[model samples]
Target chain A: MTKYVIRRLLQMIPVLIGATFLIFAMVFALPGDPTANKCGERPCPAEYVKKFEEEHNLNDPLPIQYAKYMGKLAKGDFGTSFREIPVKDELSERYVVTAKLATIAILFETVLGIFAGVLAGIRKGKFIDNLVLLSTLFVISIPIFVIGYVAQFLLGVKWRIFPVTVNANATGLDSWWQLLLPGLVLGSVSVAYVARLTRTNLVENLRADYVRTAKAKGLTTSRTIGLHALRNSLIPVVTFIGADFGALLGGAIVTEQIFNIQGVGGYIFSGIHNRDGVVVVGAVTVLILVYLLVNLLVDILYGVLDPRISHD
Target chain B: MSTISTRRGNRAEAAAAPSKYQPQDGLLLEVDDLFVEFHTDDGVAKAINGVSFDLRQGETLAILGESGSGKSVTAQAIMGILDMPPAKIPAGQVRYCGHDLLTMPEDERRKTRGPEISMIFQDALSSLNPVFPVGWQIAEMFRKHRGLNKSESLDRAVRLMERVQIPAAKERVKAYPHQFSGGMRQRIMIAMAIALDPAVLIADEPTTALDVTVQAQIMSLLEELQQEREMGLILITHDLGVVADVADKIAVMYAGRIVERADVYDIYARPGHPYTRGLLDSIPRLDQKGQTLSAIGGLPPNLTKIPAGCAFNPRCRMADHVCRTDLPPLREVEPGRESACHFAEEVLRG
Candidate 1:
């Protein structure tokens, strides 16, 4: 297992390099000059442009520029944004908020989704099953932005159940409460997917021959479904949830934007708007690393869930 | 045959106090006039139509049938494991030890399972829970039924594995089901079924998924286990070759009904029903190597719309006006033998 994990970690290096390079190339290819909008609305003075180009290596070819950025990145220097603020400092602050949001979102989906799914699966073709199917369909069909805004307006503004937007200055429990609404909004679609995936898998496993054997063993319905059937059913659901956690960590752009949560999504969004290649590339690179780690974790978990799948 | 009278006497006493009844005269299980129907989208498919059989302690009763002939369904009904909505027992009495299992409370019936009655299914790989270790699956019978602790149950599980002839039981106790070969997996399944020393062990086509050589090994293992425990074994199978040596009595099913039933040797030598004769004839013989093998023509009737008379009438060579107009009831054609056919005497004579 240790050797397998080491192999997996080594495999991530090339993927990380390839992903960062593609993002760097795309950001460099975007229209508009980074130096143009820096000095008020007018074009920068010739002297200022020369100084900026020389310092930032803007006159160098794209490949050379990328190479220089990568050289700094290898030493943990994320470089400075166009406004001269360190991208690392910006990312560290924003990533914490995004991490909290993703954690809460994941918890909401895993707990509620699996609960509802097991209920629906056990009582398949009944009223509760139909209700779950219809509601999850409803949640899946609507876009996240609509759900976010609508939830913000009603649950936050109208009902006063939660605060309208997350307090940027708040800390500890107060900040968690503020993030809860956005978290729910962010997790709404995934909850639907998780519930559906769980329901389908659970229903199928309940009919499996092993389940019948469990019943024939004189196991009570609860023990049969809860232990024997549910253990196998949750394998695929866990993989989906783990991969979804990685995707969530990448940040929900529209959800973050609607709630004004200072997360990775908003950080990357503004970086693209300002065409600040350093911030964009830095944030995306960290997100890519997180995704790879989560995927690796999921694969490891797969071996644990199913003994037939050996890491060796 | 005298045990039947003793069983009836016990039944009368059992009716006076049902819960106090116990198996007397070696009557381990009695499935009486059981009828099973499956409610499908098309219609209700009559899977088992008034099927009845009995198992005695230390005796093996082989239920012989083709696929979809309700052999497995009969076993499921006895185990009380049939999925109720799709598969319902409209009318039946499954008496285990003179107590009516059909009328027993679910909790009480559940208690009887594993310790009183247990089943092993076809496709041992699928039957055993894939995620759990083979020993753990066997150990579960003890854990759930006997209230044994994890370590104690696991200790017993190892003993069972060794008893089933699994090599290196201690080392492979934690190995999963897929790690074992086909025959080994089936042995694990049998070990699980007999874990609590169940009085009645229903094997639903247990050797169907195994190779020929492995099939023989599994059968012998089952026979040895039955002899050791004096357990009533219900061997559900399609292979005539497998049943001849192992089964004490044979019940030949066609279209969800027992078409013929007799002592193993009697049925094989002189089949009293046309369907049974067809099945016996279809078995390949080395003596007639150059001759074309005879086969039962046509398919088993669709359960939703069985033939008006006898279910096997469409495929029977002797099917005539009387055969098409009236369903032949399973009746005694000879002492200790029953055949469901209007021309039973003629078939027997032939």
Candidate 2:
């Protein structure tokens, strides 16, 4: 088992490299120039542009600049944020807010999604199956931005729950409560997609011949499902859940915009708008890393689910 | 949803169905005019129409029939494993020791199915679960029926594996069904069927899917087990050659009814029913050298649109005007040998 895990973990390097390279190329290959964005709307003075250009290594060729960026990324240097002022408390505090919500939302989504899916799949023709079918459809059909706005209207503005938008001036615990509404609105949507994927996977698992044999053994239907069916079904669900979770972690740009949460998603969105070159590329790079890591974790979970699964 | 709910319901019923067949104080199983039908889109496909039989201690009754002969249906009906909707028991009484199996409570039926009267399915590989170790699968019988603890259940599994003659029973008990060959798997199925020492065993086509060599081995194993356990064995099959040496009595099923029933020797030597006679003649026997082997002409009649006179009238060469216009009652062709044919007397006297 240990050898299997080690092999899986090591196998992630190529996947990460491939993902990082793709994201790097996409950002660079886009129409707008990163250096032009760095100069701002009014355009900098000749000397000021030159100084800024040299400071950011714009004088280097495109290939050299890309290599240096990847090199610094390797050394854990995310680079200076594109802002008029220096590193400050406001930005750091906002980053923590988004991270906390993302972590909590992930935990809630995975647990609830997998639970409902497996439960419904095993019971198959029961009420739980119908509930899962309806719930996933309901969640998947709505847009994430619409989900945020609707949640704000119903739970925030009308019901007087959490604040509709994060109070821009809030700090620490106050920020969490202010941002909690957006998290829930967004999390529910992910749950729908994940649950549906899980249900389909689990249903297939229960249909396996082994499952029928388990039932024949006169094992209670529940034990047959729990011990024999659940684990196998969870293997496929892991793939979808991992991929979806990584996408969620990549940040919902519309969700951030509507909620007034200045987290990674908003940071990236604002970076593109304000031509903050460093933040845009840096945010995307973080997402790639997260995506790669999540996939690797899923592969390990697959092995846990089915012992036959191995990297080597 | 409906299909699944019904299957779940049937599974529950099948598990419970056998408990109703359990021996109360003396008798283990009883069936009287049991009628099972298939509810198709067109109409009810009467699979087993008015079939009745008794199973006693240490006796093997080989219900012989070709495909669609209702031998398997009778066994399924007795076991209460018949899937409903597509299949239904319209009217009939299946009583196990006076506990009406058809009308028994669900939980009691579940208890009877495996504990009191278990079944060995036709396709051993398909019937046994592929994921679980064959031993655990066998042990499941002990756990469910006998209420053995986990360790005890697992241990019983190993013992059953050993008893079934699986190689390295201790270790093989941990291997999955796919690891074993066809014959070995059928033995595993046998081990499971006899797990709780059920009062009655319904081995439906147990050796049908096996090779000729494996077929004899399974038949002998069943005979040995039947002798040792003294449980009533109902061997449902089309192979007369295999059952000739094993069966105590032979019940010949044709077109959803028993056309003839007799002692194995009587059925083999002086076959009573036309269908039984045809079946006997078809076997390439060493005793009948240099004789043209007789083959039964025409296909068996479909149960849905049976002939008005005798179900077998269209296929039988002896059918006359009387045979084509009137139904033949099951009557004694000779002592203890009954044949359901209009010309059974003339055929017997010949």
- The estimated TM-scores of all candidates read 0.96, 0.80
Residue-level lDDT for A83 in candidate 1: 82
Candidate 2, superposed: residue stretches over 4 Å from native: A1-3, A29-32, A37-41, A46-64, A84-148, A161-163, A166-243, A254-281, A303-312, B1-27, B278-307, B317-325, B346-350
Instruction: Supply DockQ values for each candidate.
Output: 0.85, 0.17
lDDT, candidate 2, B231-314, per-residue tens: 778999998998989999998888888889899998777888878888877889788999999899999877777778888888
Model number with the top DockQ: 1
Q: List model 1 lDDT by residue over B215-318, tens digit each.
A: 99999999998877677899999989987899999999988899999999999889999988998899999999999999999998899999999888889899
In candidate 1 the C-alpha lDDT for residue B186 amounts to 93
**Most lDDT-accurate candidate:** 1
Over A206-293, each residue of candidate 1 has an lDDT whose tens digit, in order, gives 9999999999999999999999999999999999999999999998799888888999999999998888888999999999999999
Query: Which pairs of residues collide in candidate 1?
Result: none
Candidate chain B TM-scores, in order: 0.93, 0.90
The candidate that achieves the highest TM-score relative to the unseen native structure: 1
Error of 2 at A57 (Å): 4.2
